[model samples]
Target: MSTAPQGTTGGKTGPARETFSSRKLFIISAIGSAVGLGNIWRFPYVAYENGGGAFLIPYLAALLSAGIPLLFLDYAVGHKFRGSAPLAYRRLNRGAEVLGWWQVLVCCVIAIYYAVIIGWAAMYTWFSVTKAWGDDAEAFFFGEYLQAPEEPALGFDFVPGVVYPLLAVWILTIVIMVAGVRKGISRANVIFMPMLLVMFLVLVATSLTLPGAMDGLNAFFTPDWEALAHPGVWAAAYGHIFFSLSVAFGIMITYSSYLKRKTDLTGSGMVVAFSNSGFEILAGIGVFAAIGFMAFTAGSTVEDTAVAGIGLAFIAFPTLVSQAPLGSLIGVLFFGSLVFAGLTSLISILEVIVAAVQDKLGWARVKASLAVSVPVALISLVLLPTTTGLFVLDISDAFVNQFGILAGALVAVVVLAWVLRKLPMLSGHLNRISSVKMRTTWMVLVAGVVPVVLAYILVNEIIAKVSEPYAGYPAWMLNTFGWGMSIGLVVLAVLLTLIPWGSGSKDKHDPEYEAIRAAEDKEEAR
Candidate 1:
């Protein structure tokens, strides 16, 4: 009767087995992951620090060469196998399976800390909307909530009251995960993403009306070539590009696994990447416009650029809101937007871990979701009690984000683009619906050039951070410990590829794989 659901024939693993097209979900999931904390806080500061307008040069360069290419590569690998990242490697090359699991492991570490920060954003948003605390809100946040001893002191203390909001955020995330991909994640993104876009546009429009907005625009756009000479600028640009685009994380790979066979992988990846870049540009306008207006009025130097984090929102934004008309209402909407952005990204992170559990353990979706949630909640609880939980998030983010993410990305590029012959097949499949095509040489660049650049960035970052030590490492060994952790991840990926996994002799799983395929076919025909 009905010509079978569109994707059902690809097997239980195919996206058609669910109600959402991987293409649609991919866009939602990709956008959800992209528009988060970094977009709002980090990009403006990094640009300001890295020669203002000149930073755009390398950043846009990276978007084309590094960010977009890898995005397509990840989607191709995931959708081709229709399995979790680790299992995708096992299917493609048995030895490479070790590399895949390493990636999955990175996601495990990142997702835990990510949930804690998302909880923090949620608490901020809640406070914003209800005007719950009023004028006392700032004091309550920095004083009672953050437990700083006094204004601007930045001292840390434990607050027993912090656990309640953290628990609320954790529970909310779990509920979303329990809904499964189609109903929960996909549907929510379809709604939230459009709202995010509209709200951002509104923010940008209002910002332009602020006097001295053009001054800020020039500061961001007019390039100073000298910045390009400094390697650190390049490194910052590369890292920001990766972070903003949400590449090299298992999030993209995990999202792609749910994709359908007929979906245009290249097209989808391009759309997500381009859309993300558009948001970054818009975010840049909104942030700098305000910064510019403030600088113009306050007589602050361009060099006196502020650093990244919720501090920008908590301190700078509130200051701005306090000065502007309808300050409280605008502040509420701004932070509320951030809460949604954080939640959407949080949802994707939880989904990656949940998908891994469901596949590996053969658990139902609900159990897998819960199993993943409990452990993360425990980790969040550890940080929730300390005012320096933000500090822990920073440390974990550095080790996992800068070192772990870069390493994971380099490995993925090497394995897929070079060793696995990713581009030729990937390009052939993806180019069918596209105008521009990836050449073999392009794949080689992705495999070779990109990793080399990433490797350079990783090393330089270690030197720069250790040499400077923004917060000052307590001892020499602390610096040593950080390097060891970073290097160990790279070494681990290399070692696993060298070992033998019984030469594929123990069991023939292809029959089981094929049986699943046949069931998928029958389901499609139904």
Candidate 2:
């Protein structure tokens, strides 16, 4: 209920919020966040696994029903409140501020390991010249390059190859964040996004010319219509759309909080959602085409060569580069695209943490940026660039994405729909500012459909993980890195909310807050 002093840009605010220079900048930066390493590395394999070309039906349906609706909700909340997640949520219901902190904490945990992946991309960008991964790409990536230990619990032992590049990545991220939102994040995306598209297109074009490209495309697009009936396929479609769009992570909310008042919230959400999914489709074509070439070389089928996550990016792709015509050049373009995609996404993730610190503590932007970045950088340098880094990163990524991001989002929807009963007001806000007006259907999706789907995903994933150790890793490893980190994040979020909100005025005492309260009181009286 606290508010900023007079002269703030928004009528109700706690701190001075940053705005993107234009709608174009906001959309591009948003697309950059959405079109990340997952688009290139995760989506192709997900499609191949989940009914191939027919996966598109469920994926697009999820986008419409869940993805875009949640996106529009986040945009509406942020723009209407004119603050970061914590401040924005606090305005809605003071007790719900912890939800925002939970999201920011999730972003911090993600940022810690995400930087390490960007570092790997950086190293590979150089390694592309010589195909340094050599003949056994898998062995080279896991054994020589990463020096992965025999066990997940082996602990950190720094590898110089990864540590140096990781340090460089952290430095680059800190520099961009320090430059402020419009000057740093916006401008960087202007350059990175278009370049990413051009490089990816070039790689895709080259991949299609390779021998057996059609076999890869066939493996990718050939549909098994029966797979649509399976509950798991629909779940995978929803999960991919959710994660790929970067919702439920506070990235979209924070980014939207930086927009001008008159911006089209629904139109912007549509652009970001469609742009992200479109890029994923393009990535599927490119990835499968390259995999086909690899299969042709190995005398195997595209299905045999298929993989996902880090393996697909660092191992399968490198092996393809070593065998393909103009292998070195292709390698450069491929990894270079990864570097750009990872950097832009990294910037967006870091911005969430930085914005939270500034909003809560009234800290200068530089101080906030450095305060969060320095510790995370040190952690990355000491732990993530080490022998057991990949195992740690893998476990942490799975838990944080499932437990942290999704759970926080579910809480938000329940509070808005059932607890506060604010969905109608939020829908009204979106309709007022957007060219594409939201209807009751949009409200149903946000308040009812999306939350139900997310809750199912959360419960189903938890049951699956508890019933069996994930990926056959030891129980201790899952307990330590997976469940342990997730529990720690929740504890941290609660602890953060206990800190007194340092806004200059008392809660529920600010003029704007009183006015809102008065209006609600009148509505109830009527």
Candidate 3:
């Protein structure tokens, strides 16, 4: 075992690891990562579809039992091991390095497709001004705007509108990553997260003023007690929580690795978890209020107009923008929020890859950021920003998230908790530095409980995807992008771990890691 001061690693052993300058920045940055595209566009509809107000019970339960618990788990591992995912897990135990790579590759896949969605949002933010979709929103989106082919082939017929903004997004991401953690991530979150919040709040306020806003609010909050009795709703809560908090995909692990040694690990986790959830609830309010207004004007039921994902954001909202008074303002606010939220989350996702590369290659921060991002950006530009990109985006997101992130997470908890039996050690690390101490209950939940839920989710997803073609795509298409991509990620990750680690990573040499190991060894001997 070895020991040395942190933040003292000088040039060329890889740029000295950077940290969030304060707990406040760390918390804000974490929130920014967590409150992403899913929070704004996906959550409102998820809550609405699942029991509405009653869904909160299971949602809160999932947050407490799994979300923050897993949050603590990531913080303890990264902060204690004090490196990127691969480095930290390798330091945890040589056998565990692959888990980190799996997560990094997952982030890489996500970052590429994620940028294109942000590009769409950025374009729509401009489209808001003139109600560009005009009389038929769906027609404009699918036909004139995207110009997606009648068939979803992996085509390279580039859509200039989509490519331009996506290119801009990648360029901006490169600049930020080159800025490093404090200057890049922290500052981006500090600026953008608040702007996102203020903008969304204004959106919600304006949404509330729409003629039938209360109807939407009522629809959102009105609880169906029966939905709770079904297990699927509970599963949905846990599922959404996992994605919403950006766990299991290496983002939190990498982010937590940047935290100061003496930081309040659990306290910060709490702030991030709650703030993300609060923002989600607020998003539900804003989205449904507008939907309610749309329903009112169309003389239709709320359920008829309510939708989620791309439909809600592009098709439905654009229609609302066409109809609502000061319509353009609402569109700007909503789409701007999406652009900001997506960027914050996108940068965080890419950082997992950037940080891992920096640690693995022992490259300087700027070198690693460019080395990782440029190739990734190039891949995104080639694959996305084309006629069939939305299909690619949808399928890649579905399979990668389910198999790559969800399965990787399940494997991580099982290995760390059961196989390696590291929960005690990891829990001890948290209790030592955290404001809120970890009780044995934390171990039970992380080890005994969360895995069961994750296993269920993962199994169901696999069964469903295998049994039926995802999104009704051609079998070959699904096989190539959907199944092939997910399976390839795991194989690639294992291969990546075989590459030799850089000497400059040096996290294993951290004094704190040595101290923790020494204590564990002494306790075992005793």
Prediction RMSDs, each to the true structure: 5.6, 3.7, 2.8
Instruction: Report the lDDT tens digits of candidate 1 across residue range 156-247.
Output: 45566576767777787788788888878887788878887777787777777777778877777777889999988887887788878777
Model 1 scores worst on lDDT over the 10 consecutive residues at 1-10
Candidate 2: RMSD to truth: 3.7
Question: In order, what lDDT does every prediction score?
Answer: 0.68, 0.85, 0.89
Clashes within 3 Å, all models in order = 2, 0, 0
Off by over 4 Å in 2: 1-15, 503-526
- Residue-level lDDT tens digits of model 3 in 229-334: 9989999999999999999888889988887677789988988999999999999999999999999999998998898899999999999999999999999999
Cα error of candidate 1 at position 453, Å: 0.7
Kindly report which residue stretches of model 1 are placed more than 4 angstroms away from their true locations once superposed. 1-19, 126-143, 148-161, 418-423, 432-436, 465-470, 476-526
Q: lDDT by residue for model 2 over 1-526, one digit each (tens)?
A: 1122332222333334567978989999999999999999999999999999999999999999999998888897777776678877888788888888898989888898998898898899888897888889889998999999766666667899998998999888889999888778988999899999999999999999999989999999999899999989999999888899998778888998888766888888888888898899999999999999999999998878999989898999889888899888788888899999999999999998888887777666788899998998897788788788888898899999999888888988898888998888888778865789998999888888898889999999999989989988988888888999899988998899899755532232344434444664465466
Best by lDDT: 3
On TM-score, the stronger of 2 and 3 is: 3
RMSD in angstroms between candidate 1 and the native structure over all alpha carbons: 5.6
State model 3's lDDT. 0.89
lDDT of 1 at 466: 68
